[model samples]
Target: MRFIAAFAVFLFHLTMLSIHTPHGIDVLHQFKDEGVREAYNSVFHIAGFTGVSFFFALSGFVLTWSARSTDTLTGFWRRRFFKIYPLHIVTYAAGLLLLTGSAFRASDDLPGVFLLQSWIPDARVIFAANSPSWSISCEALFYVLFPLLLPLIERIPASRLWWWSAAMVAGIFAVATIGHLYVSMEYQFWFTYTLPPLRLMEFVLGIFAARLVILGRWPDIRLAPATVLLVLAYALALQLPQVYAQTAVTIVPVVLLVGAGATADIEGRSRLLRSRTMVWLGEISFAFYMVHLVVLLSARKWLGAEDSYSTPKALLVIAGCLAVTMVLAWLLHIGVERPAMRHWSVRRQDRDRGRTTASV
Candidate 1:
């Protein structure tokens, strides 16, 4: 599911760049007919941004689901840092190397390198050095707060968790409505779209949903129906005004899907998500998400500064870039991510020692 969501974001980026930039092969505009182009945009373009929302929710759910009672806050932080930063640093450097001569700025570089870029309102800063990594900034905020938040979350009585979840959802809707009505368009984009604090609500909801399931208080919502609700909500979101659309419109469905997946796992019912191929892909999904934009942008640069290509050629380019991105992602997962987690992550040495003692 994470892999699928990451790929959706990748597709969204590709289509968006095709529409806005002159550097890439314009995949969407390849169709000469206006109607075909509009149809393509209508179907493929609107829903891709929801992938990020999926990720935010999934992060909360997965982290909460796997959290150990004995785990220390420092230990959790160390593990998360090791899990994400190595890949982020590598990709950030790669993006810098690729954009060497193109509008690079020292001001943006500082925040970007430290994963603080999202704090700034400027898109150039927020999207600096690996544009996709701005989300990491948000994730960092979530990680920092998780230890503090979890104890409070666990304190909520299981019976009342549903109401608590509802309250959070209501809060999200309220924030969205206020932002839509009161905030200016420019600031609204910063506040509702890129701001880490605002985005933290989705993460919080994820935590809440997971706690409900942990207590066996999760609503008895099946995976299929939850999935259907997600699709419907996403479609309805697309029809909404841009302000509301960019807000928490699909948050309810996202939470439901995450909760449903968790329930599926706990019940030991076999699902497509547990399949080996998907499991592998999900493992590398973070790396894939980190590297894909650079891969696409580099491909565009290599394609000789052309503004657009014929439909077949543009599609070929997109396919080729995706292939290369996946290969690089797999290599990064094996080389950088796996090794770092094994050696540098929390309690690896202790775990190994325990295993040795057990074998003896």
Candidate 2:
């Protein structure tokens, strides 16, 4: 599911590149007929953005699901830092090397390098090298608060978790509404969309949903129905104005879909998402997400912007980039992510040994 979401984001970026034209001369204009363009826009324009939402929610779900009762907050933080930062720093440097002449800005690079770019509302900093990493800033905030947040969440009665979930849903809509009515378009895009604090609500919703599932209180909706709801919500988002669409219009379905997936896993029912291929892809999904934009930007630099490609040529470019990205992602997962986790996530070693002794 995560790999699929990342690929959706990759496709969205490709589409954005293809349509962007400077001086009224789009290179892709020659190949894209009006009908094709309109179809592409209608189907893909907003759908890709939802991938980020999926990720935010999934982070909450997975962290909550795997959290150990005995784990300390510092232990969790250490594991998370080692898990994400090693690859992040490596890819951040890669982005700088590949895009130095173009999108790279020294002033923006400082914040980006430290994963603090999303703290501010500046587009230059928010979208600096490895632009997709803005979400990492938000993730960092969630990690900082997770230790504090989890205790509060655990204190809530199982039966009351659904009410908390409901409140989260209300908060999402409320933020969306307020942003639409009160915030300027510029502030709305940066503050509402990219700010870590605002995005924390989505993460909290994930945590709340996970608590419900842990308590056996999650709704009984099956995976199929939950998935259908997700698709329908995405479709509805397409019809909405850009402001609401870009906000949390589909958050309800997202939370439901995540809850359903967790339910499926706990029930031990086989699902496509658990297949070997998907499992491998999901394992490498984070690396793929980190490196794909750099791959895309490099490809564009070499082959000219995506607008330069004809329809068939663009298809080839997308295919090629996808292949290269997967290869690189696999390498990074093995080379950086795994090794760092093995070496730096040392706090859990005693716990693991204790578990082994008890089981024996």
Candidate 3:
């Protein structure tokens, strides 16, 4: 599921390489006559936005579901820090090295270095170092709050989980309404889409969904129905105004599909996405998402600013980019992410405390 969402986002960016970069304007020129625009407007655009929302919701779900009663706030935060920051730093540095002078700003990128860019309304700040990283900023905020959020969610009566879910869902819409009515067009997308606090609602929704399943309060929605709902929501997103369509329209379906998928795992039902290959891909999907844009943008720079090619060649470019991105992702996962989690994430006190054998 993570791989699917990351790939959807990758495909969406394939059609949206900025016109500002050298020959970047011509990047999609070959697809001018193709269905790129229609495809984006109808589906890929929604996929790109909702793909990100899916990540936020899934983070909430996974963390809440796996949270241990014995874990302390510092331990939880430490593990999460190890999980994300190493890869983030590697990619953040790589992104800085590749960006053009216009795209890279020393002062503006400071916020992004710490994954705090999402709070700022200015695109220059939010998108400064690595544009896609704006979402990571939101995720970091979610991690910081999750320990606090979990206890609050745990106090809710198990039976009222659905109502809590609805409230979070409503909060998403309220964000859209505020962005639409109050924010200027220049910042509305930033306010509604990139703001960490607003996006946190989806994360909170995920937290609630996990508790629902843990408490056996979840409904009997099959994976098929949940998937169908996702498709229908995507279709509906196409007709809605862009402001409301970003994450607001598809939150429920995305969260439902996530919960349903988890429920399937719990029941050991027919699980097509459970293949070993799929699981490995899901494991590295984070690295893939983090590195793909850097890979694409770097490739474009190397291919020359004025390069143009047939749609076939352009797609071949995408394929090559994917190959390179995946290899880099694999290396990062092996060389950085896993090792950090293994070594640095656990404090000496925790390890010493967990040991079973008595020492002299």
Name the candidate that leads on TM-score: 3
Instruction: Point to the candidate with the largest lDDT.
Output: 3
- How well is each residue in 1-360 modelled by candidate 1, as lDDT tens digits? 899889988877755543233223354554445565566677667565688888998999889989998998888999999999999999999988885447566986768889898889877777766789899999999999999999998898888887887887787777778778998876776777778988888898899888888777788888899889988887888788755666477888888988888888778764688999999999999999999988877777676544566666767877898999999999999999999998888686778887999999
Ranking by lDDT: 3, 1, 2
For candidate 1, what is the lDDT? Answer: 0.81
For model 1, what is the error of residue 323's alpha carbon versus the real structure, in angstroms, after optimal superposition?
0.7
Residue-level lDDT tens digits of model 3 in 85-148: 9989888888777764456566677788889888987777786655688899999999999999
Which pairs in model 1 have colliding backbones?
A: none
- Candidate 1: segments with Cα more than 4 A from true spot: 18-34, 100-102, 347-352
Q: Give the true-structure RMSD of model 2.
A: 3.2
Q: Flag regions of model 3 displaced more than 4 Å.
A: 17-27, 30-41, 101-103, 352-360
Residue-wise lDDT of candidate 2 within 212-315, one digit each (tens)? 88888887988889889888888888998765676478888888888988888778764788899999999999999999988877777666543444568667
Q: What is the TM-score ranking, best to worst? A: 3, 1, 2
